[model samples]
Target: MDEVQVGAGGATDFARWTGEFEAKVVARAAAGDPDWARGARLDPAVARSVQRFQVGESGDGANLIGKADRAGDPVYSAAVRLFIAEERNHARLLGLLLRAGGQPTLSGHWTDAVFVRLRRALGLRVELMVLMLAEVVALRYYRALRDGTTDALTTQVAGLILADEQRHVPFHCQRLRVAFAASSRPARLFAVAVWWVLMVGVTAVVAVDHGPALRQFGVRRADFGRGVFGLFAVIVPSAIPLRDPVRIA
Candidate 1:
């Protein structure tokens, strides 16, 4: 990945994002990976949960890249490629974590299948909206996995993925801010409403699906849902300004 720095006001600076991602790639290479040889001890439920998330992260991202190319922003397109690479790296990390725990990665998961279908069913803006949902949900999940687990290797892997996911959210948000910049107030408000509904639905599904694992980490299902909502509260305003925003020239 490259090194990227969001400029003042978090402007749409894809070049910075590209550099950041590249820098991350360099840093990751230099740091190397966690010692998988130590092995991990994962609860059965947690292993199952991680398997599903691994499936979610394991995608070619061809559709997203195609959409980005069609968007006609070459810099953004390049940055998106690095973003996808990082996501695939997340899958790799999770798979290795499972292996360390003597578990196999799932061949597929219904939740991931549905999510991929939903994201690919629309244009880049819509795709990004759907992707943002995953990114935000992952924020809470990886945090719990990192902080709640006793296994040092599992914690390390989760922490790494969490770091990338934190970057991913605002990166997508910056693009989406531009995407909605030309919309009317009424339109923006409507988008905010719709986004809220979708977020609630998705969070509920995830909480229900990962309930056992979340409980293992001492996170109540309701608490998980609330946490996701809390995160999205910030995102909705950032991504879709309901008030008339000064156009970014």
Candidate 2:
């Protein structure tokens, strides 16, 4: 794999991200998982919905790691590994939450399968772009889970994953800003346009697929889609600048 070049003086420092992820590792080790003995009471609709998200979060991330390593930024590669670990932890937490509620974790889901295929079909930049759609969607979905649910254990678990995801959007943006720093304006615009299209399509699928659970959470399907696009509106400019980014850090 060839290195994705960023113009000199424009490379975003990823050491900050590495340090943040490391600090999180320490903090998580200290704080530990939410008490599962308390158990959870999930609506059948919500449980089915969470089962699909758990599958989305579960992956080896070898392809992403390999691409990061070949991108020639050890600090960024290290940060990406930490990022993947946190995602896996989300899957674990969700699985545990489901078990505590007497629901079984799913082996797979068609939606997750489609996302994995789409992400794997591209290079590092494109993969991250595809991934950002999921991240943005998760930001909303988890927030709804955290705030809209009456289940204490579910709220706690969603809060934890939501916090990590809040950081994840900007972390990916920092790298993406650098990735696009050398591209032409028209190219960046084209990429952003495509990203928006993908976001709309994916959000629509999720909104329909999870509408029942979202209703249980008191969020309408239209509102869920709106919230996802709202988050994405903020992310696109951060990741893809129409004018050259002044600084990515």
Candidate 3:
């Protein structure tokens, strides 16, 4: 499949991955290994949240590209295409990690429904900014796991996922820059407001729920904080300059 063109939609592949992952999770759960089961369970909620985030904004991102294509915004279109592809890959990686850990794939009904509503209510720029916030949270979570885990498989999976996520940083930042560039003054202020809300909201949710889970996995919560801060430092610098026009393709 050409990377330049959006490949056939990922729904079919995503379904297959979901089924296979659930089966693996069920098997692991039945094995009666608490550590394994618990570790695996982490994958489900995380996957559900991510699935919601992606499905919610994917169409807007696509529509943006479609508009850019019509308007001959090749650079933006190409970047958006890469963004879509990265999101698709991200969904797959989350599924894979869940399966490897032996957790069931949670029903994404709520996320899907939410995405439907989000499509109607939000613009592409707002949606994309929200996605960046999600990714920032994910990068922190994954990095924490990768750094704090002693399990070889967990570390391996986390590392692999992190690699893909790292690639997304630039794509998301570029999209944010483009969106900012195209926005009017009022829109820019609104975008900043929305971004602040998302970032704060996501951080709060992560702080509340993630601590217990990490403790269950024998990971120190402080270590998670360190990982998150480390990621924040790196991502903030990279994302700041994104307001400047740069060639991403």
Candidate 4:
């Protein structure tokens, strides 16, 4: 059987993504860890924001892996596992950074708990849709963290995560495009409409919740909201066939 017929579509080959993920792993190993010894410092508001994000990064990977296994593709399943590892590594890096800053990681965050539960109730297709929302928001969040901060260590970590996230968008897009391949025109429209709404809601929450930190780093809350929306509009259509990607003017 072909790979696309199994948990993929729109000419997306999970094998290709798998290869890319594998290469990333190799590159990451070669690059070694970020200069963690350099230490990091953040304002109180920023530290709080980073702590919440750190909690968000460390998530229920087993839930996603189970869904991927049920999707019936070993290659995709392997890739998902690798993807989970990358996320785990991110959490670890953030935790170390927090310690370096003389702060403790939060044991739990209510929003992360809710987000994890929401994704657990979804199938691989819908789960990726929800996960993509976080990914897009993260792209902007990390970018701001990278460019807005004066801390070298924070910038390094943010840049590393941002590069991985840039790859993640297209990785999911290929599969989501496949998942929506069979939907009718109206169905696709409705799904996109609902997705856009959810995206807006989540982005708004993040902007408000992290407002003080963003402001401290010189990012306006409204601008963060606009940035993710712009990024989302561009890629949203790529996940659904029969629609052109929206251009942000």
Q: lDDT by residue for model 1 over 1-249, one digit each (tens)?
A: 122222223366688789989999999999999999999999999999999999999999999999999999999999999999999999999999999999999999999899999988999999999998899899999999998888999999999999898888878988988888778888888888888899999999999999999999999999999888888877777778665463574
TM-score for each model:
0.95, 0.94, 0.59, 0.92
lDDT value, residue 149 of candidate 1: 87
Q: CA lDDT of 66 in candidate 3?
A: 59
Candidate 2 worst ten-residue window by lDDT: 1-10
Worst 10 residues of 1 by lDDT: 1-10
**Tens digits of per-residue lDDT for model 3 on 79-131?**
55655654565555555555656554444445345534564465665556556
Model 2 agreement with the true structure over 27-110: per-residue lDDT tens digits: 999998899998999999999999999999998899999999999999999999999999999999999999999999999999
Which 10 successive residues of model 4 have the least lDDT summed?
Answer: 1-10
Distance from true location, Cα of 45 in model 4, Å: 1.0
Instruction: Count clashing residue pairs per candidate.
Output: 14, 0, 2, 0
Model 3 worst lDDT run, 10 consecutive residues = 1-10
Q: Quote the lDDT for 132 in model 4.
A: 91
Q: State which candidate, 1 or 3, has the greater lDDT.
A: 1
Q: Which parts of model 1 have CA positions greater than 4 angstroms off? A: 1-10, 244-246
Q: lDDT of model 3 at residue 133?
A: 63
**What local lDDT does model 1 show for residue 13?**
63
